[model samples]
Target: MIVLALCLVDEARCWAAGESVRSVVDENALEGTPAALWDVDGAGDPTIQGFATDISINRGETVRFKVTTDASAFRVEIYRVGYYRGAGARKVADIGEAETFAVRQPECLKQAETGLVDCGNWQVSASWDVPARSRSGVYVARIIRSDTSGASHIMFVVRDDDGGSGILLQTSDTTWQAYNDYGGNSLYEGEPAGRAYKVSYNRPLIVRGSEYRRTSFWANEYPMIRWLEANGYDVSYLSGVDTARRGHLIRRHKLFVSSGHDEYWSGDQRDNVEAARDAGVNLAFFSGNSVFWKTRWEPSIDASGREYRTLVCYKETHAGEKIDPSPLATGTWRDPRFSPPNDSARPENALKGTIYVANCCRFDAVTVSADQAKARFWRNTGLDTLSRSQSVLVGLRTVGFEWDSDLDNGSRPAGLVRLSSTRLDVEAALRDFGSNYGSDTVTHNVTLFRHKSGSLVFAAGTTLWGWALDATHDDPDKQSAPTDLRLQQATVNLLADMSLFPASPNGALVVTQAPPDTVPPVASIRSPRTLEDHMFHLPVSVSGSATDQGGVPAGIEVSVDGGANWHPANGVSDWSYTFTPDRRSFVSILARAVDDSGNLQPVPTSVTIKVSGFARLIYAGLVGLVLGCGALLLAFVARRRRLLAKRRMMGL
Candidate 1:
C-alpha cells in the first residue's frame, strides 16, 4: 500500500513538472523499489520465521517444522485449534527455546508457465511427529522472538479422521494462495490485476492483505472455528483441496462447512459435494458463491523439490478458445462465455440450490420472513425473541460485497424452505456488463432444503455471515458492525440443532427421519381435467396430500396423453394447476405425488372431463365413442389370442 501511495505521488509530481515519465521510465524504477516488496510478513526484521514439514499429516505420521531466526533467540510454541471451550487455541506443545537459523528469501520473479512468485526453499531446524492424541485442525507454530515486540506464526493441518458427527471446517486455502502477494506476484497483483493464472503454496501469504492479516484463516476461518469450539461443538478442520482429493471423505461426517471467501473449486470437488449430499451428508455453505468454478489439479515439484504444492485454474479470459481439450475446462461452471464449447455445464445451483447472481451491492439489512418465524427451522430459538426482535437480524451492513440465492433454474431441489432475504439495489456498473448478471434488483435468500437422503442443507446466502460470528477477533477492519445477539443466537441455535444427529458408537452417521415424508404421497385430480359449459367452473387442478404417516408432499406433476409428457404442479399446500378448456370435448390427465424422500406415489390418479361446447365437441365426442367401443371389443378378442396380442401390445 505504501508503495502504491508513493508511486501515485511520483506520477503527480512528474505530471506537474511536465515530464512524461511513463514513456521513458527506465529500469531504475525496478532497482529503486524497496525491499519490503519481497518481505513475506511486513515486520522489518521478521520477528520469528518457520514452515511446516508437510501440508497434511495422518494421525500417526511424523509432523515436522523448520524454524529459524537470523539473530534473536525465539520461543517456539505449538497450539491446536479445536473445541477447547472455544478459547480459540489450546496450547499443546512448548518446544522451549529454539536455536536460530537463516531462511534465504528468494527474489520475487513471475514464473513463465504459472504466474506465482515462488519463495522459500530453506532447511529445517525442528521436527515433531504428530502425536496420536492430536485432534484434527490447523496447528499453528507460534514463534515469539524474545527480543521483539510481537510474534509471527506459520501453520499446517493434522487430518486424523472423518470427524463423524463433528463439523468439517473447510479452509479456503486455495483462495488464500490466489491472494498471497508474497514476493510481489500474487494473482491479485500485476498489470490489469489477476494476471496470474496460478499460485504456489511454496510462498508465504501477504500480511494484512486479507482480513485479520492472516490470509483466509485468521480473520475468516479461525473466528468461526473458535466460536463453534468455544460453544463446545466438535469441529474438525481440512482444506477444500482435501475434499477434492478424497471425494467420499465426508460420508461419515454429519455436516460439512465452508469458511468465508471459498470461491475457487475443482470439478472433482463439486462432484464430491453433490454425491455426499445425495448420500445424506448435511452441508452448510456458511459463505457465498460456492462451487462456481470447474478446475483440475496436476502434480508438480516446486523448486524446493517438494511434491504436491501448487493451485492451477485456467479460469475466465485466461482460458482462451484454443486451449487443449480436458474434461476439466478450468473455467466458470455456468457462464457460457467462459465454459468450453461442447462441455456439459454444471451450475452451482444444482448443489447449493443457489449461485452468485449479482455483486457490488452494499450491505443491506437481513430481514426474516413470517414464513421463517413459523417454520421448523426456528427450533430451539425462542419464538418470543425471534418475533419481537423487529424481524431484522442486522442492519444494512449485514449483507454485502457479494450475495447468492436460489436462481430460477429448472433444478432447484424439492422441499426447500425460505427463512429470510435481503433486497439489494445493484451497482450500475455490473448491470452495464450486459450478461445474465447485473440485475437491477437482486434478492439474496437464506434458505434450508431437506435432501431426499433425510439431511438438510442450509445456506446463509451472504459473504458477510462469518463477520457477524467473529467477535473475538476484534481486528477493527474485520469487526462486524452494530453487532447484536440475534445474529449470534441464530447461529448458536443452528449449531445446536445440527448437533442432534450425533455419530453412533461405531462411527456411523445418524440419519434423521423425514417427518413430512414418512408416508407415501397420494395424487388426485381435485377438479375435472376437462370443463363443461354448464359446469359450476372450468376447474383444472391437480391436488394431492402425503400419505397417512407424512405431512404435505414436496412435489406433484400432471401428465397428459397417458404419461407421454409431464409438467410440475406447484401449489401452496397441495399441487394445483388451472387450465381453461380450449373447447375440446374430452381430455385425459394423470396426477402423481412426490414426497420429500422422492418417493413417487403409486396408482397415479386419472380423470377425463367432457366439456359441453357443441358442434366440434359433438363431432369429437362421436369419434371418441366409436373408437372406445371398437377398442373394447378388440381388447377382448386379443385377450383370447394372448401370444399374438401380447407381441402387438409390446410394439413388437
Candidate 2:
C-alpha cells in the first residue's frame, strides 16, 4: 500500500508543476538555414499572422521592414490617411499588392512543431513619389499575423535638420461620423447625400460605406508627406496618440500638429496636448474645428466579429450640459461652438483665411486700410486681411473676417482670422504686425482656459501649411501660391521677435553683475527688536533715498540695529525704516539696497535705540498727588477749629 501511494503522489506532483512552453516565433534562426518554420503555440491550433510596417522615403530613396509569423494564409494591407479641411478620416488606395517587386524571401525559412519555431524573415522595400507639396510629419504602417491574432506597428517622421524645419502631426485612434453615432456603420437620419450635396449644407456632413471607412493607413497618398518628401525633407511617421499616451508623445516633438478636422478629443488627451503647449510646445492647426467636441472611446467587438473602436460625442447629453454647455447644438455635433464664443461679424472669424474660402469659392476680398510704409494691399492672403482690418480699427479685431469698421466698432482682434484679402504686400503687413501682437493675438481670446505652464501657441487661421506650402511654390498643382516671398521673410522677421521664437543673444551673460545705484534697495530687520513695554513697530525701509543715474529711485532695504540683520521691505514706497520696539531688553535696526542684478550696496544704513522703564515713574507721580491733597485737607480743618475756639472765648 505504501509503495502504491508513493507512485500516485509522484504522478500528482508532476501534473501540478506544469510544462514550460514557448509561444512566440523567432525570425533570425531561419537566416541562411534550411528549416521548415511553422506553428505558433497558443490556446488552440497554430495560425499564421501577417503585418505591414510603414516607412517614409525620399522620391528615390528605398526603405525596408521585416515580418515573420508561423501561421498560414499570411497577407498585408496598406492604405493612406487622406486630408481635407472638414472631412474626418477617409481611406485611400490599397498598397498591399502594389509593391510586388519590393518583397523578398526571409533570410531563412523553417518549420517546427516542437518547443519553439523560427519563422524565416521577410523584407519590404519601396521608394516614395514625392509630391511637390507634402508637409513633413509622421506616417504609419501596421503588421498583423494573417492566420493569428496579433499586430505590430511602425512610424516615420519627416525632418529637415539643415534648415531646422520639421512638421508635427497629431493623429487620434477613432473618428466619428456624427455625434453619438457609436456604430459609425449607420448614416445619420438626414445625412449621406454625397460629397457635392454635402458641401451645400455649409457645415461638416456625414458619409458612409467602406469608401468612407475610418481605419489605420500607412501607404496612401498623404499630401503633406508627399510634399515634404518631394522637397527633400526627412520625415518621421508616428502612430495615432490616444488619451493614454498623448502626454508622452507630445513632449518628444517641438511642434504639435493636428490635421483633417480633428473634431473629437478625449478629455485627458485634450488636457495633455494643452499642457504640452503651455510648456513652450508650438502648435499648428492644419485641420478645422478642432477640439470642438469631447469624445469617449468604446472598445468592443461588433456583430461581424471584428474589433470596433468607436468614438462618441455626447456633449449635449452630458450631465452638466447647461452649466458646462458645449458650443455645438443638442443633436448636431457638427457646429464648432468653441468656448468664449466666436464672433460672427463679417471679416472676422477666428478660423478665417483665404484657404477655405478660396478653395470653396464662396467669399470675396474686401478693401482694408492702406498704409504705404506698412506695406498695405487688399489682394493679400488671409494674413494680409487680418493686418489691414486691424490697422485702421480702433477696437477689438475679429479673426477670419473682412475688416468692417462699422461692425467691430473698436475692439481687440479675435483668436481666429478669415481674411478676405490676399496681397503679398498685405501679407507682409500682417507679418509685421504679428511680431508685436503674436501673444496677444492667440492667447488673449482664450486667457481664461490657459495651461499652467507658459506654452507658445499660434493659430494659423489659414490652412496654407505655412513653410510646407513653400515647397510647392513652383508646382502646377499647388492650391494657393507660396505665401509671398517678401511676406514669408516678414514672417521670419516676426517669428524672430515673438516670445515664442526669441532670437538668441550674442553673449551668454551680457549683464553678469548689477549696476551701481541703478535702483532703490529694499531692506527689513531679520532679528526681533525688543522694547521696554511691547509698544514698538518693526523698522523696515529702502536704503538711501538713492537715485538711479537715469533719475529713477533706486530701490532699498532696511534692518534694525546697524546692519545686524535684513528683510525685504517690499511694500514701503519711501526710504525710511521705523518699527515699534518689542517688550524685550535690547534691539538693533539695519537697512541696505540691492539692484536688479543682485548687487548689494557698499554699506548698510542702520539705527539703534535704548528704551528705559516708564511704568514705575507713572505710579510714583500718582502717589505724590494723593499725599498733597490729604495734607491740604488737614490744614483747612485746623484753621476752622481755631476760628471756632476764638469766637467762643470772645463771646464769654
Candidate 3:
C-alpha cells in the first residue's frame, strides 16, 4: 500500500464551499496509465506529431490542433496532468472514431530570411470545446496513429480566469517555443545566419522524449503540479501569453508563480508581473534563466491576424540589432544599448531578486549555510538538529542546467536574503554553453525578500527545484536526484507563511490578502539646495532621494530640459545624475521616481539653473588653446631630444 505523506485532506471536504482546487483533484479520480505508456518513445521523424493552435484556452472556449502525419488516420486522447494517487494524469476526453479528427494538414510554410517555420497554413485536424466544469491545469493531447503504432503528444493549459485561487502558475511556453526546432530552425540554430531570429508558435514542438519533454513540461513543471495537487494547494494555471494579454487576472490571485526555464518575456508580460507584485501579490519564481531574453509577439501570416503566434528574439548580445526587424530591442533584458533606445533600462534582477549568471548542464545540490538553516522557512525540516558533520544535505539536486546568483549589480531588491548557497564547478559544465561571468566557480542562491507592499517574493534560483517535489516527474537522465521530504516540508512551511493554508484538516483552504498599494512615491531633490544657480562652463550634478509606502522605489529618472527627454538615474531611493548642457542656457532639471508597485511620481522636483553662454565659450577657447599649445611644446621638446640623442650616438 502506498501512503500519502503530505496534506491529503479528507475526501469529504474536497468539495467544500468556496474551494475549487480540492474538488478538481478528488472528484472522479480517473485511473491513469503508467508513465511509460503516456509518454512518446523511440522517435525519428515521428509518423504522428501535432501541435495546439494556441498555448492555452479559457473555459467554454474551443482549442484547435494542427497535425502532420504519414499515417492513414489518427485519434486524440486528452488528459489533464495532475496527481491521482500515484498516477500523474487523469483522462478528461477521448476523440476517436471521427472522420474529421483524422490527420489532414498542408505543407508547413517557411520564411527564407528568418528561417521561420509556420504551420499556421495547416488545416485544423481536431478541436475541443473545453467544458465549463473542466479543471484549470496543464492538459496534454496524445495523438496516436490508428494504422500504425506511432504516437506523440501536444500540450496546452486550461485557464480558470474566474477562479480566485491563492496561486496562479504561469507555464514557460515561450521558452518551449525558443528551443523548438521543428521545420528547419529554432531561435538557437538554423541556415541563413546560424540561428533564427524569430520562431513561430504555430509549428509542432519536435516529439523528442529527451529534448522537448525534458526542457519543459515533464522535467520541470509537471512534478510541481503533482506535488501541489497531492498536497492540496489552491492553485490555477495559465500560459505566458495569458499573462501578457489577460494580466489583470493576476490581481485576483494572492500569489503568482513562474515555473521552470522561463527565459523569454515580452515587455507587457514583465510590466503586468511587476504590477501584480506592487499590488501585494506574492511572487514565487521556481525557475532559472527566467526573463533573460527580451522578446515581442507578432501576428502570423494567416488571414486571421492571430496575434502572439510568433516569438521574436534577435539575441543582440551576439548578433546585434541589425538583424532585428522589430522597433523594440529583441536582445538580453540586462543590456540597454539598443539603437532605438530602450526606455526601461532595468535588468531582470530588478524584480527577480536574483539574476541569471551561468549556463546549463550542472546538477549541483543546494546547501543551506549553518547560519541560514535556522530561518523560519526551515522549520520542521530537521535542520535545527543539523550537526557540523551532517553538512551536505545530499539528494536535492535543485540547482542545475542554468541557474541564478545574487550578484550586487545595483538592481538587486532591498532586504534580500540568501536562504541557501551552493558553489558549483562550472568550468567543464559551461564549456559548451557559455556563462555570463565565465568563472571557474559560480554560486547559486535561493533568495527571499519582502516588498514594500507587504508581499513576499521567493525565488528558487534554479531550473530543477521542482524535480525535488514529486517522484512521478520526468527524470533529468544521468543527473536525476531523488525527491526528499525535507524540501516538501519546506514548501508547505512557505505556503503557510504566505497566509495561505488549509483552515483545518477537513476545512477549505484559506488565503488572507493585504490591500493593494495605491499611493505614489514622493521624490525630492537632495543636492543643489539653491534652486537658482549660475554655474557656467561646469557640469551640473543632480541628486535626490525618494520615499515610497511600498518599500524601495523602483527607480528614479532625471530630465534636464523641462522633461522633453528623461534618462534613468544611477540608483534608486538615493539617486544621482550628472549632465553638461550642450549650449549654455537656462535649463530646468527635473527629477521623478516610480515605486516598486508601478506607482509613478505625478509631480517632479524641478530646479532651474543658468549656464552663462559667454563664460562657457570663453572657457572652451582658453581650454582648447592651452591644450593645443601644450601639445605643440611637448612635440617640439621630444623632437629636439631625439635629434640630440642621435648626434651623441654617432659622433661622441
Candidate 4:
C-alpha cells in the first residue's frame, strides 16, 4: 500500500499552512512503445483550417481566426447554431475571396495514438470580433478552398458573460484535442508530429466529425448539445477552457454538466468544482473519467507577446515545466508518485468518489449495483422494488472505451451510493496492477453521493454514456453505440434529478473570500530527506508541507518521481506517504506549500533519490514471478469454465 502523507501545523498555529500542488509521478506511467512512424499526411484537400483565437470567447470580446491553406484564396463564413426558430445555423460573418496565408506543419516532440498530425504553427485567416448583441452558443467557421473546391469548418463556443441561466454545458474540447487528427497528429496519434508531452492549441482542427459538424461533436459532445438545445433546456455553451480559465462563472448556473469523453483536467478545474460543490452548485459528470488527469494551462501568446490566443498542456511529462506555477504531470489523476507526498496525492477518487478501473471499449450489458437495484435513482427506469442486478437493464451494449470503479483501498464519499456497474473481463497481462485486475470478471462502479452542502456528485462510469441516448453518430452505414429506451429514460431521470434540488451551503457561520497572497509559501521534505544505495523493494517514507503564513494551508502535495506530477496529500490529522520503488535509477523528489490566501511555494524543496541497481533487478524478478503465477491461474480458470460449459451442454 502506498501511503503518501502531508504534515501541516494545526490550522491555529500557522494561520493555516499554504496550498501545495506537486508535479505528479505515479500511475499510468504511459508505457506502450510510441508509434514508430511519422504520420504527417500532407494529403487530403487543400484545406483552409484554423482555430478560434479562443474557444470560450465571451460576447463582445474580439475573436480571431487563423487559417492555413495550400490554396491561395478561400472564403471564410461564420455561423451560429442554436434555436434560431428552427432555421439551424444563421450566417453571422462572411469574408469572401480572401487570400489564404502560409500553411506550415511543424512537427511535434512526441507520438500520438491515432494516425493524425499536428500543425503547431499556421497563418491567420481573419479576426471575427463579436458584437455586443451576440448570443451564446456554438459558432463555426466555414472555409471554402477555391483551388481544390474543398471545404472545412472550425468550432468555437461563444460564452455569455454569466453563462446564461439554467444548465451549463462544459464541452469536452480537451477530448477533441486528444483525438484531433488534423495535420496528422493529436494526443492519440503517431510521432514526429504528435505533441504528447505538450500539446498547443494554436493550430486548426480539421477532423471534428465532418464539415457539417464538429469532429467529436457527433460522437461525444454535440449529440447531447443538440438534445438539450432542441428540447429547450435553457442551456448555455462553454468549452472546457471556460472551466479552466473562469471557473467562478460556474456560480451563474444551477447545474454544471461535464459533457462527453472529458478525460483531461487541470488542478484549477478540480478546485473550482470542489469549491462550487461546497457553495451548493449541483454537478453532473455526464462522462467517465470526468476529473481524471491533473492538467495545467499555458498561455499561447503571439510573437509580439501582446496577445494570448492559444492553450497548452504537457501531459504526464514535459521538459519546460520549470517555469510553470502549478506544473502537474499531465496524466492519470491517481497515485502518490505523481503528486507530492506532503499532499497525500489527491486521487480522482477524492472528488468523483470513484477510480478508473481499466481501458475498455466493447459491448457489455448494463445493470444496477446489487445494493442499488431498487434505489430511488432508478425509480424512473421501471426497475423499482422488483429488480435484480443480475438482469440486464439496457438490453444492449453500454460499456465502452473506459470505465470507473470504487477503489477498495480508498474511502468513498460519506454517503455514496453505488448505482450501476458491469463485470468486466480484463486481460491477465496486468497482474502487476493487482489480483483482481486484468481479469474477465471485474466490476466497474457508477455512483451518486451528496455533499454536506446539499449538493450531489453523480458519475456515469462509462465513456459512452451518451451512446445510451442517441447512436446516430452522423453516419448512415457506420453504427453507433446502441441507444436504448431504458437508457434514455434513465438519462432523463438523471437530468431531472440533477436540477430537482438547489445547492445549499454547509452553513459555515462565517464565510469570506480568501485574501490575495502575492507572496509564495516555503516547503521542504518531512521524511527521508536524504538516501543512498536504497533497494527498490524497501519501503520509504515521504512527506512535506507549505507555510501558511497567516492563513491555513489550502492544500499540500508531493512528487516522488522527479517532477512528473504533484499529487494532493489526503489526511485529516497528519500527512505522509509510504512508497516502494519498483524500478532502478535516480529519481527526483519535491514538495510545495499553498497558503489559504492562495499563495504557493515559488520554488519547492528537492531530494535526489539514489536506488541501487541490484534492488531494482530483484523487484523486477518478483513482478515477473507474480505475472507468471497469474497467467497460470488464468489458464486454470479458463479450463474450469470450459468444463462447466461442456457439462451444461450435456444437460448435466
Candidate 5:
C-alpha cells in the first residue's frame, strides 16, 4: 500500500503537516471534464481505478482528496501535464488503506487558487489567496505521487492578484545567444550583446525566443540596482511584463532602470519608456547596449495548458518564417510599433557632461595635485586614445560626459579643474604601482574636457565612478595615487552643482555671462539713406553681410529716410540679407544678429541707395540704347587692349 502525508507553510515560512484527506472542488472544473485513470496493481494489469472527476471550488479555498483503491496491495498515483518546460508539477495527495488509501493536501497549495481537478485515484484543487506583497503573474503548483516503484507528476496554475507589475527585459533578436554567456563574444556574463553598428548602418541584432518572453538574464550583478537601493530607492525585480501595461507601471516609479546589458526592445516598450521620460520619470541606462532592436510577441499555449509566449524579430531562422522587411526596419509591426524611417537621431547630449565613449579606451583617474594648478590650460596628448581612431570619438573625451566644445570651452573661471597632458613619469608611476595595461610608450594624448553641468551628470559617467573609488582613500599619497583625481574631482564638482538645481524648491533659472570676446559690438547706418520701405517680390534680389562676434544676423531693416523709421528685410542667410531696394525713395539697409540667448546685437552700418529724379531719367534712358552701345564698345576696346598688351608683354 502507498501512504502519503502533506505539509503546509505560511507566507512567513511557518510550517504545518496534515494526516487526513478532504475533497475540495474547483468551480472552473465542472462535470464532463476529461479525467485520467491510474492502475494500482503491480501485476502489470491496467485497472480503471475510479476517482472523483470535475470538482468546483471558489477562490481562496483549498480542496483535498482521499483515494481508496479496491486492490489490497496495489499502489496508485496521479500525474498532470506541464504548461511549459522547467515548470514543475504539484502532488495533491497520496493514499494507503485496506483495499483503499487516503492522501492529504500540502500547505504550500493553500494560499493561492490553482485550477487542478481530481481524477478519483488522486485529488486536485486550487489555492486562491495569494499574499498582498507578491508580484503579479501566473503561479504554478506541482503535485507528485512517489514511491519505491516510480513517480507521477501533475501540474496546475494560479493567477496572481496584481498581474502586471514587473518590468519586461528584452534583448536584440539578431544578437547571438553565444554572447549571452559572460566571457562569450567579449561580453561579460549577464550583459546582453547589442548590435555592433547604428540602426542607420543596417546591422540590427535579431531576436530569438518567445515574443512574450521579453526579458533575458544576462549579467547577474546589476550595479545600478545596488546604487539605487543604497540611495533609498524602491525597485521591483520582475521578468516579462505585459506590453499594454508598461505605461502604467512606469508611472508608479520615479526612475526606470535598464540594468545589465539591455540591448533590445519592442516598439511599444521603447515608446512607453520614452513617454515616461517625457513625463518626468527619470531613466538610468545602467546597461551598455539599450533599445537597439525591435521585436514582436505572439501568444500560444504550452503543453501544460498555460499561456506560451514567443517573440519574433528579423533574422534568418530555420524553424520560423523571417519577418520580411522587418517591422523594425519597415515600421509596420503592431503593438510596440515604432514609426518607420526609424529615427536614427540620437538622444540630445543636452544633459551636460554625459557622453558615450567608444570601446577599449583606457581611462585613468589622475588627481590635480597642488603643483599642477599653475597651468592656464591642459590637454591630454596621450594617456587615453580612442580605439577606432575615428574623428567622432573626439567628442567622447571629457572629464564627464557633459562637456560641450562650443559652450564649455573657456566658460569656467580659472582654478576650475582643467585637463593637461605631459610626457612625464605619470605612466611610470602607475606602472610602479602595478598597473600594466597603460605605460610610458602610450603615444597619443588623452583629450579631457571639464564637465559644465556640475557633477550630477558627471557621476553618471562610468569612468568617474571608478575614480570615486580612489577619492575615498584617507592617505594623501594614496588619495592622489590614481593621478586622475583632479579630472575626477572636476567631474564631481559639476555633478554637485547640478544637484543643487534639482533639489532646490524654487525653480530658479541659472545663467552665466558670455565671454568678453563673444559679446557683439553695436553699429548703425553710416551711408546711403534712412530706415524704411525696401519691399520686393518673391524673386527679388539684394546683397549684404552682417557682422557679429557671437550672434547670427537674423534679419535686416531698411529705411528710406535716415533714422526716422525702419522695415525688416525679406530673406536672411548666415550674416547676409538680400532684397530689392525701395523704388520710391533713397533706401538705407541695417542688419543685426539674434543670439541664442535672445539678445540682439547692434545693427551693422547701413548701405544707402541714393535715388534722384534726373538720375532716374538718365538710368531709364541708358537701360537699352546707351547701355548696349556702351557694353559693345567697351568689349571691342577691351579685346583690342588685351591683344596689344599680350603682344607687348609676350613679344608675340
Candidate 6:
C-alpha cells in the first residue's frame, strides 16, 4: 500500500506562514448582506436584470453595467463572494439611489434574423472604478430596483493579473451564457433553426426566473468558492474569457482548477490550460462536461462592435441540419468532421482524462472498491476500513447532472487511475449533443493521472462533486443532498498533496512523503499460455494481468510481431489484444507494462505458439481432392473395361 504519513513540521510551518491572498482578504471583518435580503427570488420579478460590459477587469479598471428595467432607478451592490465568516459574500461597494450612479436605461435591440438580443445599445446605468488594492475574486452586482420591487444579479471577476496564487479557479461563465435564454435566445435554444448559433454576452444571463441560479454562479461554482475559502486555500478566481485572452496569468499559478459546468471552451483556452499542465502546474477538474464544445469569440453585433463579447458555437451536431458556415467550424471539440479548413479534433478526454457521457442529471453515488480506497488520496477517509464482502464505499449525490466517462481513445493520458466507478442507465435521458454516442449505459469515473512532467491531473468526473462538500449551494433541481465528510476529507488530501496546505482547522490529515518509484511493474500473459491454448484457430487472442506495487499501472502494450511493434491495449490491470496470423507459421505474442511513475517493465512476458491449423487444413483439402479425382478416374476406367469385355464376348 502507498504510505501516508505525517508531514514534516518544518515544511508545514514554512507554508503555515505563507497564508494565501484569499485568506488575508477574508480576514477583513466586513459586513455582508443576508441571502434573504440580497437574493431576488423572494423580492420580485427579473425586470431589474443586467450584465457587465466585460466578464473580468483588472484592478483600477472600470466595469460598466447596462440595465433595462421598469424601475426609474436601480442600485448596483458589488459583493465579493468568499467565506467571510460564513456569510458567503461580503459587500465590497454599493452604488445607487443617486441620479449620477443609477439611471433609466434604453431598450435593448434584438436581431430578427439570428434572434440575438443585443443590449449593447443600452446606456451604461452604473460603473464601478475598482480599487487598485482590491482582491481578485468573483463579484456579483446585485441590481435592486429603487422601489425594492425587484432585483437581479450581474456577475464579473476582479483580476489580480500579477499576483501568483497557489490555485486559480476558472468560473464557467461561458456555460452560464450558453444556457441563458434571457432575451429569447441562448446557444441551446431560440431561433428558426431551433437554437441560436451565435450567443451575445451583452444581455442579462438567465434572468427569467429561479433557474438563473441553477446554471449561473450558485449551481456548481459557489460551493467551491465557499469550501476553498473556508479551508483557506490560496485560491484566485478568473472567468473563461480571461483564460482565453490573458492566459499567461495561468502559467504563474502552481495549480489551475476548472470548476462547475464548464462545457464551452475556446481553442485558446484549451491550449493555455494544457500548456500550464505540461509546465508542471497541477490540474484539478472539479467539473464535468468540460471542454465538450468548441466555440470562438466574436465582436458584438451592435454599433460599438466590441470584440470578444459574443460566443459563437454552431452546435452543428445537435442541429444536424447545417454545418457552421465559418472556416472555423463550431461543434464538439472531439469531432474532426468539421467542414474542412478548420476542425477541433481534440477530445476532452485527453486533457481531463475523461469525457462527458451522460445526458441527464441523476444523483448517483460515487462508489469506490476496497482496493481503490487504499490509494493515498483516500487515506483516513474511513473507506480503507471496508471489509472484503462490503467491497464498495459510496458517496451519495456526488455524481450528478451530466457526468463524464473514461474513453479508451488513443488520446488518453498514460497512468490514468480510476478512483470511483458509478454506472448509470441513460436510455430515457439520452439526447444527442453533437457526439452520436448512443448507449443505454455510461459509467461515470473519477480519475487521476500523473503527467510525464510529474504534474498530477485529477478529474471528479461528475458536476456535483462540490455538492458533497457544501450543502448550502443552490441546486437547479432543488434536491437536498447532505454533506459527505469522506468526500470533504478526500478533497483535503488531494489539495494537501498538491502542496497547498489547509490554513483552516481540518481534522487529522496525512500527507504522503515524496519518494522515487524505482520498482517496475510485473506483467503476465493470462491467456494463450501454452501451445495447447493456441491450437484452436488461425486468428488468436491474447490477454494479460499487470501488478504495480509502487503505484498503479499506467498502461499495457502488446506486441504480436515478435516484439517488433507494440500497441496499447484497452485496459491496464486486465488487458486484451487480438490479431490474425498472416502466415501459417509460428507466431509470438509479448506483453509489457509501465507504471504511473514512469517505471517500465524490465522484462516482457511472451508466449510463442505454432499456428499450423491453416496449413494443415489446406493440405488435408488438397489430399481429399486428389483422392476423389483418382476414384472418379477408376470408376470411368472400370465402366469402359466392362463395355469392352461385353463387346468382345458378343463377337462384334
246, model 4: CA deviation in Å?
Answer: 0.5
Give the runs in model 2 whose Cα sits over 4 Å from its true position: 1-167, 172-221, 226-240, 302-308, 315-454, 462-652
**Can you write out model 3's per-residue Cα lDDT over 331-355, one digit (the tens) per residue?**
7778766636545556777888888
* TM-score of each model, paired residue for residue: 0.69, 0.34, 0.73, 0.61, 0.32, 0.83
Overall local distance difference test of candidate 3: 0.74
Q: Of the candidates shown, which would achieve the greatest lDDT relative to the real structure?
A: 6
Choose the strongest candidate by TM-score.
Answer: 6
lDDT string for model 1 (1-652, tens) is: 3443343345333334543222101201212222122112432235355556456676557666655565345666666654333345545455655443434434434566556554435556556665554457787766666666346666678775634535777777777666666555555565223456566666544444443243356655666665555444556666677788866778778788886667778777777888888888888888775675555665434445454466666565344442424544666666555454566666666677667766644666676643345343443344435543356445345565566766545556654545576666676312311133544777787766667776777777766676665554434344356544456566654554555332211112123322444455687665653442332235555455433234445456666556665555654234466555555456667777654334555567788766555565567779999999999999988887998878899999
The reply for model 1, stretches above 4 Å from the true place, is 1-50, 66-73, 82-86, 96-100, 108-110, 162-165, 191-194, 210-215, 303-307, 317-327, 336-343, 380-397, 428-439, 468-470, 474-479, 482-652
Point out where model 4 deviates above 4 Å: 1-46, 81-93, 98-122, 181-185, 188-195, 206-215, 301-327, 341-344, 369-373, 385-390, 428-440, 474-482, 500-652
Choose 1 or 4, whichever is better by lDDT: 1
Please provide, for model 2 over 17-82, each residue's C-alpha lDDT reduced to its tens digit, 9 standing for 90 to 100. 542210111101111111112111111121222222222333222334443345333333322222
Q: Is candidate 1 or candidate 5 better by lDDT?
A: 1
- What TM-score should be assigned to candidate 6? 0.83
- lDDT (CA) for every model shown? 0.57, 0.31, 0.74, 0.56, 0.28, 0.75
Higher-TM-score candidate among 1 and 3? 3
Which lDDT value does model 6 have at 160? 88
Off by over 4 Å in 3: 1-22, 27-30, 42-45, 99-104, 210-213, 339-342, 386-395, 428-437, 502-652
* lDDT tens per residue, model 4, 1-652: 1111221212112212332211111101111112111111222244456676567688778777676677767777666654333333445565777443445434432224322223334445567766544557787776667776576667788888744457777887766665565555555544533444445566566454433122355455655654455444566667787787788888878778886667777777778878888998888776765666556665443343222223334443332222223434554556444455544456676787676666545446676643344443454455654533244456365565566776544444543555666676765312222113455566776676667676767777766676665553443224365566656555555555555321221122111222333565566676665765567677867776545454444344566766555654543113566677777878677776654223456577788778676756778889999999999999999999999999999999
Please give, for residues 232-328, the per-residue lDDT of candidate 6 as tens digits: 7778878999889888898888899988788899988888998988899999999988898988888998799998888888886676534666677
In terms of TM-score, how similar is model 1 to the real structure? 0.69
